[model samples]
Structure formats: structure tokens, C-alpha cells
Target: MVAGEKIETREERIPLWKLKLDPTNVRFSHLPGPLSDKELEDEIWKENETRDLMKSIQAAKGLIEPPFVMEGDGYYIIKEGNRRVVALRKLKEAVDNGEIDDFPASYFDKIPCEIIPKKIDPIRMDIMLAVWHVSGKKEWDALNKASHIFKMHRDKGLTYDIIAEYIGVSKSTIKRALLAYEECQRFLKKYPNDPVGIKRFTYFDEFFKKSYLVQKATVDRSFRDKFMEWLAAGKFRTHRDVRVLPDILEDTDATKELEKGTIEDALNTLYRKYPDRGDPLWETIASAVEVLRSMPRSEVKAILEDQAKRHLFSNLVSEVDTLKAELNRIRNGRSSKLK
Candidate 1:
């Protein structure tokens, strides 16, 4: 039940059998298993993350937070605690089988849940999912969160302002999420199941999140199509290479250099022509690493002395520790081989 809503609400200890997995859960669709297993998952179980939760609950002897839900059709549709519910179900089964000596029916029989009346609107339920998933505790991945907002707006006919208010994000953010998902569907149509290309979903988020990049793609369909074609064909090797596209669009000389087929040569041309135009964060980090390899001690000290810059320098020191361990392990392996 919504804590502040006027609707009827009460905490109940419901048997695990009555709590069905919300089939509409965004994460539910992506479980890696056979179709039968996937189907059974919504009705019976969960995999991956739920496994970790199952162990935690078994150790804790009970769930920490009650699942919030509303009755739907025949079962309680979980709004906030899907992972916890799945974890409890696993614990219940273990107790039934006497597989664990300590866990018994008393510990697993009925789980706490906050329930709302069955008459609540389903779209409101979607917004509740958004509150927890978008900015709240159980944050979904970028693409997952984007897809839900797009669906709610496109399919459910919710206005951007209404959705924005419900989810507590700006309308512009909602627009970017929609754009990102639309691009994902379009990209998938071409590649279908190419993991190498699909792995670039983060790049998609990075590309769309920038208002400038999206603005160019919007006004010039040809530019948008050609740029994405580069991504699908693997012409661009890294996300930074893709991210640099919008900036290149502003420079015809740079664009021509990039079209010559090497991201490095293109970026070098951009940097040389426009000395201030730098790569985004990761590229900057990579460049910083290269500089650090040959940089003077004076430069490093100056950077570390600045309070705002100390954290990354400190992180680099920790990385050096990991590198030391790796070097020692390699040396030990070689010594054993020689023996």
C-alpha cells in the first residue's frame, strides 16, 4: 500500500503461494533460461540477483522490508520488493524439503506485505515501480528505466508532465529516455542478436543523454542514419569515438578526416585543428594515464595538492598496488616453469 494514500491499507502476513511474481516487472523478461524456465520463473522462481538475496534472508532469518503490493486479478502484484519476495519463496521451498536444518515452517510460512485495495489503477502501479526503480533504492539499469518510461508514455497514454511528476524526473529526461529506447529498438532491428554491438547500449545512453547530440540527429536524418551505421558496422571502435561525432558534425574538415576510416587519425585531426576540443571522460582518463606514464614528478605533485583532484590520484595509487600483485604472480609462475 502507498503509505500516504487514502486508499484502504494494512499489513498482512500472506502465504508465499498467494504472492505471484509480477510478470510486468522489467527485469523479469531478461532472465537467461529456456522458455519453459522463463515462464515458470514468473509463477515459481527468479534467478541471478534473487539467488544472492536468498542467501542473505537465510542468514538473517527473515526479510528486512515487507513487499508493497496491490491485489490484481488473482494474485498480489508486487510493487516494490520483487527480489525479496522471490528470495522468501526460495527460503520457503528449502524449509518444505527440510534441506536446511535451522529453517522451519514457522520462519517461512507467511511473509509480511503492505497491501492496497484491488481497485487501484494499474498505471499508478507503474509510477510506483518508477519511484523505486528510477531514483529510489532499487535502481534499474539505464536502458531498463528508459524503456519503462517510454512504454508508460507511448502505450499507457500518460503525458510527459504527468509521467515526470509521477516519477520525479524532468520532462526533458523523459524525452531522452524515450529517444534512447527508440534508438535501441531501431538498432536491434538491424543487428538482431549481435552481442558485440548490443554491448554498446551504454554508448546509446551517453549519446542520447546529451541534448546537443540528439538535436543534430533530430534535424538531420541522414547524419543520424550514417552515424548509427558506423556503430552497427563497427567502424567506431569505442564509445568515445561515437561520442565525438556531434562535435565533428560542426567541423567539415574533421568530419572528412573521420570518414577516412580511423578514429585515432580523426580524433588527432580534431585535437590538432581545435586544440581545446577534448575527448569525453574515459578518453580524458586514458590520455591522463598516458601523460602520467612519462610526466614529471612536479606535475603529479601539483595535481595531488589540489583537494578536488586528490581522489583520482589516490585511486591510481591503489591500482598500482593491484599491478604489483599481478607482477609478483607472473614472476612466481615463471620461476616455477624454469624449475
Candidate 2:
């Protein structure tokens, strides 16, 4: 039960035909029009692990966990486990056609379900779904999660605070998801026929989270469009490449390399221009400093009390001192050359 809303639920076995797929399901929200049951099943089949789930269910002979649903007049609307339902339906088809004969048709005919009353408040229902998929177990992929958050805030007109409170996430997380979702939508509008572009939600999400990149894109529409074009062109090898975009954008040579060559080429150009930034030793030292700064006081006390830990700490200090001396010597050598 979610706070402030009293939900009435009952367990029952529902016929497969009587269970309706939710068109507003976050997984298929990108589709434009009303979808038939077959269409919903087709869409659900495209989800990750659907085939694996079908095999798992075949071995188990039934669902391991019942799907959650809402009671309708003559049917029940599935709120969770659409993929599982699709798997069952497909398995049933196989059985009807005699594809595999391990299980009978009866196993797939009636599915166990946890049915919530349709009379429940719509907002509460949305909140409950958000809690389950957004922050709870049975989590949706990043794209679906962001799309759900976007709909709740934009279509349902729910405030960020309300969503964050209900979904057990920070308000900033909700806002970031909404921003990334909107950007992805804009990308889709530009390339409506490009189905593969929707899968790059993580690239857009990571891009929006970087303040430097966001500021640049916010102030310059051309830069944003160029980034979109790069995304659509599949220039970024992975989403991690998006993390170094700020550095690439800051360097003229690196940006040119990125436009013409690969992300690796652009990174090489950036590293060449700022050699110090690419130094592994400097990075290690910086990471060490960060770890030390963030270490808990309890751990620090334990280290002080333990001889082995204190010895290790002393060695680390000695290494830092040696590094500092070497850095000063190099600096002084460079100063002498300038003189």
C-alpha cells in the first residue's frame, strides 16, 4: 500500500483472453495510435529477455510470479508483467500448434493475477506504477523509466516533488529524466522513420546531465543540432563517449576531429592538446585524493588504530611526497629553461 491512498486488491485466476494489455504502457508509449492485443504482444515481444522468459516459463510450466492487474468491467488491465503475459500467449500458441508438447493448453489459459480495483484514484495508480517500475523491484530500463517520468510530469501534470516523493527518487533525478526524455522526443521528431535512434536514450540522458554540455547546447541551437546529427549518424561508439564531449567541444582541433573521424580520434586530439590531462599517474593521484577525502571517519579511526593500516597510510603519504618533489623539480627545470 502507498501512502495516503487505500488500495483494495484481491488474488484471482483470469483467463488470458479477458486480460487486456495497457496501450499506455511505458514500454510501448512511443507508438502513435491505439494498439490491438496482437499489436501489444508484438511490441512486448521486442522487449529484452522476452524469449528467455518464454523458455523459463516453459521449463517451470507456469509463471513464477503473477502479474498485477486492474479490474475492468468485463476484463482486467495488466499493469505489470506484460512481457510475461506475452510469453505465455506465445507459449500457448506453440502448444495449440503442437510446436512443443511438454505443457498442456490449460497452463496458459488462466493466469494468476493480483487485481486492484479500477475505482482507485488514477493519480494513485500512476504513483503505484511509478513506485514499482521507477524505483522498486521489476525496474524498467532507463528509456522506459524516463518515458514514464516524462508522461507523469507532462501528460498527467504531476509536479516533480510529487513524483519524487512517490517514486523514492530525488527531484533532480525526475527533472533530468524529463529533460532527457524531451530531448529524445525532439530527436525522434526530426528522424521519425529512424526506429534505432530511440535506443540511444542513454546518450541523450548522459548528455543532458553534464552542465557544461547542457549550457553550450542551451545557448547555441546549432551546437545542439550538430550533437543530434552526430547521435543520429551513430558517431558515438558508446554512451561513455558522450562524457568526453565537453572536452572535445572545448578544443577546436578535437571538435574537428570528432566531426570527421571517430570518438577515439577526437579523444586522441584532445589528449595531444592537453597532455597533462591524459596522464594516468595524475589521474591515479586525483582518484586517491578523492577516495581519501570521502573516506568515513570510522574507517579513518580504524586505520589509525591498526598498525597494518597505519603502515599502508604512511607508504601512501611517502609516495605523495615523492610525487610532489618530482613535480617541483620538473617545474624548476622548466623555469630555468625559460630563463
Candidate 3:
């Protein structure tokens, strides 16, 4: 594509076998969760959604959603709709072999494609692809998203402003994404032989935003590595846990204090502030009050509905009243003495 020139695009039917997946598609090649690129791509073909799409194509006698393509390296590189291209190819194979009752090879032989100029602008293509995959329906996971940003800026020499403008995000956001992405890369380098999947590393992206927690983790190498181990083992979970982690790091004697026996114990230690002790009685009272303070009305009502707990609450109220009366009597005695 020529700069300042209008990109001309036209639709045509292309042979199913000729179209190939584009390696440059940052979205299509990267798969979320634990699946590798090829594994996820192969798995997409086996999905029920893919099968449904094939049946629809067979019914319509053509593919309505034309896969975008541009001529490169002697073949039409599939810029988008790689999955659809794969599905069509798979459908053609099935048809040629008469795998289904009614579908035929002739019906699956060709499909619609939107062909563009051979030399489409790489920057323009990247921007369009980024928007569709990043913000559009097909959302890439945080891992892939950061990796894409890092790659574009580092390897391709694209400026942060250019990337941010196209993706419609702030430059600072892109910077943080790159930092967190690099953090994950550092982790991969250290544990090159570990069996843990790469997707788990993106979970640390949140920590980069958390300076207090991340600082301690980074400054203290052992603590940092241990926390990353917890991450790899899938122990660090829940929004509550993430929030309290820095607190544990700041106030506690050790990070292990945060990793209590069970999840419930961990939560109680975090919420109740155990071992990271304060004024003992006040801490106990404060912990109880915190639980009550955060408890929803529905949960409070459910607890109060139980007869034993209701009786206990009434006793607590009586104790509070008695305390108030004793305090009042002491105040009256002091006043009388002064008079």
C-alpha cells in the first residue's frame, strides 16, 4: 500500500487450498490460556463452533464473511480469518472423502476472499489488526497483548505514540504493558526448564501496577522468586488475596505468614491480621468489627436468623449496655466528689 494513497480492496472467490495463514497476524498466532500456538490453532478446527460455521457455509453454498488477504511470497497470505480459512480447508477435505452424507468437494472447492494490494502498508495493517484483536470480539489475553506491544516497540521499532494512537490507548498504558511483559519474559528466562505454562506468567502483570508489593518482591530476590513460585503453583488467587499481599509484605515478619495452611486460614490471617500483631484486644475487636463492617446486610441477616447466634448477639448487646452504665456511674461519682 502507498502512503497517502487510498487502499483499494475487492472481493473474489479463491481456491481453499491456495490461501495460507499470515505469520504476521499478532492475534491469530497467539492463543490464550495454556495452549501453544499450533495446539490452539489445531484445536480451533475441532471446536463445535468451527463445525457449525462449516455447516453454514455448506448451506449458503459460499462463505459470506470473506477472509481478508494480500498477495505475498507467491501465495495469498491470509491477513485475517485464519480460522475460517482452516475450517474451509478442513471442510473441503471432509467433502472430498464424502465424510458427510450431503456435503460435496465441489461445494467446498472455493470461498469468498477480500484481496488487497500486494504491498499493503505494514504499519496500517498492524494497527487494523491490533484494534480488531485487542478491543474487538477476539480479545487476546494479557500475555499476548503485552508481548505484541513489546515486540512492536522493540523488534519492529514502532514508537509508543504510534502504537497507542492506533490501539486507542495512552502511551503510559503501553509502557506499563511492556514493563509487565518484560517481567514475564525475565521469569521465562530463569525457569526455562519448568513445566508450568507461559500463560500463568501474565498473572504477574497486576503486580507491576502494585509498587509496594512488587518493590519488595523485586528488592528481596528470594521473596520475589518464592512469590513467583506461588504464582506458578496457582496458590495466589482472588482479588482479596491480591489486595492483602502488600499489607503482609509491609507489616509481617515473613511472606510465609501470608501463605497460611488452608485458603480459609490464609484469609483469616490476612483479614484478621494474625502474627502481624497490633494491640491484642483491640486487634481482636478490630478484626471482628472489620468482618462485620464488610459483611453484606444479607449475610448479617442470615447469621442473625440462627437462634444460637442471635442469643449470642443479644448477650453482647447486654454487655455493652452494662459497660455504658458502669461508665456513667463513675462519671456521676467523680462529679459529686468535685462539687
lDDT of 1 by residue, 1-339 (tens): 332354566899887777766666675444444334236455435456778888888888888878888776666777678778877766777788888779656777788899976776767667777888897888998877987887788888989998888678999888878877777677777767656644456667788866777777788877667766767666677776666776776777777876776666677777777665664765776677778799888877877688766877778789979989999999999999999
Question: Model 1, residue 82: what's the lDDT?
Answer: 74
For all candidates in order, the CA lDDT equals 0.74, 0.86, 0.69
All candidates in order of lDDT, best leading: 2, 1, 3
Ranking by TM-score: 2, 1, 3
Regions of candidate 2 where Cα sits further than 4 Å from its true position: 193-195, 219-222, 273-339
**lDDT tens string, model 3, 78-196?**
87787777777777777777786576548767778899877767766766667766656766667767777777788778898888877778897788788776766667777665455
Error of 1 at 30 (Å): 7.1
The global Cα lDDT (0 to 1) of model 2 is: 0.86
Per-residue error at 309 for model 1, in Å? 22
Report RMSD for candidate 2: 6.6
Poorest 10 consecutive residues of model 1 by lDDT? 29-38
Pick by TM-score: 1 or 2, better one: 2
Every model: Cα RMSD to truth: 10.6, 6.6, 10.9
Clashes counted in candidate 3 amount to 2
Question: What is the TM-score of candidate 2?
Answer: 0.78
Candidate 3: regions farther than 4 A off: 1-6, 25-62, 102-104, 214-226, 232-234, 237-244, 250-254, 259-265, 272-339
Of the pair 1 and 3, which is ahead by lDDT?
1
